[model samples]
Target: MASLSVGVACVLLVLCMVVPSLAAVYTVGDTSGWTTGIDYSTWTEGKTFKVGDTLVFKYPTFHTVDEVSSSDYSTCTVGNAIRSDNSGSTTVTLKAAGTHYFICGVVGHCGNGMKLAVKVESSSSTTATTTTTNPDFSYSSSNRSSFAAYFITWVALIVILVINVSLWQEF
Candidate 1:
């Protein structure tokens, strides 16, 4: 019985540590996706963004996701984008606790309202559950790998729990 209790406690401790680090993933622009003319400012409302969360921009080949400085974002300056990608799907991990700016680099896109600004709070400030902009969202490779690893960890934990239960019963 004592051994079973100790095993259960260890499993619970491991789960507690791992659960807090699991980051939430969001799809930019929600159901409409990343495109011009949609009001991005409204999309970020009611969402609590935190450091370690991910922002996935899903758009067409003709469009681009550009991370930019606050000044550049305000002016729609495509030339000075901090980071740019036109791969159709851009996965951005929020690494800091500050406002992050993004825009579409294509000519006139940002001016036409293809821009997003998200305020990321420190993880220590709050905890939010994993979420998505839409019900239908796909994971990138990094996300897939991370999920697989987490699945394996849970399976191992369950096996340990079962073994402990069996041992307890035998004793």
Candidate 2:
């Protein structure tokens, strides 16, 4: 039985090492880079942005990346930019679970609709949650389904192994 326990431990160790914590990297505007005449809203449609994911902006020297507030974004006001970058290539990570806005700082560029808005969700939100009106006790948060599956599987295997060992000893 010691060997069986060791084998189970080895399998668990391998699973822990193999299951990668993956994060997606999106190239903004696809092949067009972060420039004018690109429909950023359409590009991000049907896509779910999560924390840890990155947005890569590739543009020329004439254009600049400015992370601005929603009000500034709607009014094309780059003066209140939270973060500004002029490099040809820029990568911004979604560190928090909230909305992020980006726009070009060039005159009349943002007004010409050169902007992007992304809603970043928590990485732990793998399974979708549904709303419930039960006031007694409601579960509206994300359930750790992946971890629960792994734990249940491990417990079942251990139970099966224990039962098999008991039968073997009886013989």
Candidate 3:
């Protein structure tokens, strides 16, 4: 019984340490999905994106997710796109800490408000703050904890509580 308890504790400790480092997967535009006429700027509001995070763009075949330079994104141009995807679903992994711009490549779609600019921070960053920019609005928010971090904190607290309870019962 003691050996089993120790094994469980060891496994939980490893999971607690590993889970917080796991990346967050965000579905862009949420339930509405990636589409024109949606407020992409507001969608990014109050969200802090860290490196290693994943952004999944789900949209119809009619739309294309085109990654472009800051200048191209501002102008809604796609001929110089850094990356382009027209499939029904597109998954983008944030590899570094910087602002990434994406827009619909279809004519007038981007102009109709199908553009998103997400600012990513290094995972090691202490402060959580992100700024999402668009042609019409620029938003910056701070101090939000990642889901993984929060989940691990709760798990650790529960484990501590259980261990203390077990010890008290023994007394």
> What is residue 112's positional error in candidate 1, in angstroms?
1.6
Tens-place lDDT per residue, model 3, 1-171, is 495499568868888688777878788999999997799999999998887777888889999888888888898886787778888788777777778899999989989999999888878946534543221111222112366568778877877777787878888
Top TM-score hit: 1
Clashes of each: 0, 0, 0
Against the reference, the lDDT scores of all candidates come to: 0.78, 0.74, 0.77
Which segments of model 1 are wrong by more than 4 Å?
A: 125-140, 144-149, 160-171
Error of 2 at 160 (Å): 31
User: What are the per-residue Cα lDDT tens digits for candidate 2 across 5-102?
Assistant: 77668767765654445567687898999999988999999899877667888889789888887788889997787778787777777776777888
Candidate 2 vs candidate 3: the lDDT winner is 3
1 or 2, greater by lDDT: 1
Instruction: List RMSD in Å for every model shown.
Output: 6.5, 11.4, 8.6
Candidate 2 scores a C-alpha RMSD against the true structure in Å of 11.4
Stronger candidate by TM-score (1 vs 2): 1
> Which ten contiguous residues of candidate 3 have the minimum total lDDT?
134-143
Residue pairs with backbone atoms closer than 3 Å in model 1 (clashes): none
**1-171, model 1: which lDDT tens digit per residue?**
676678777877876787667888788988889998799989998998887788888889899888788888889988887778888988888877777888999989999999998887778846533322211222353663478478768868796878877888898
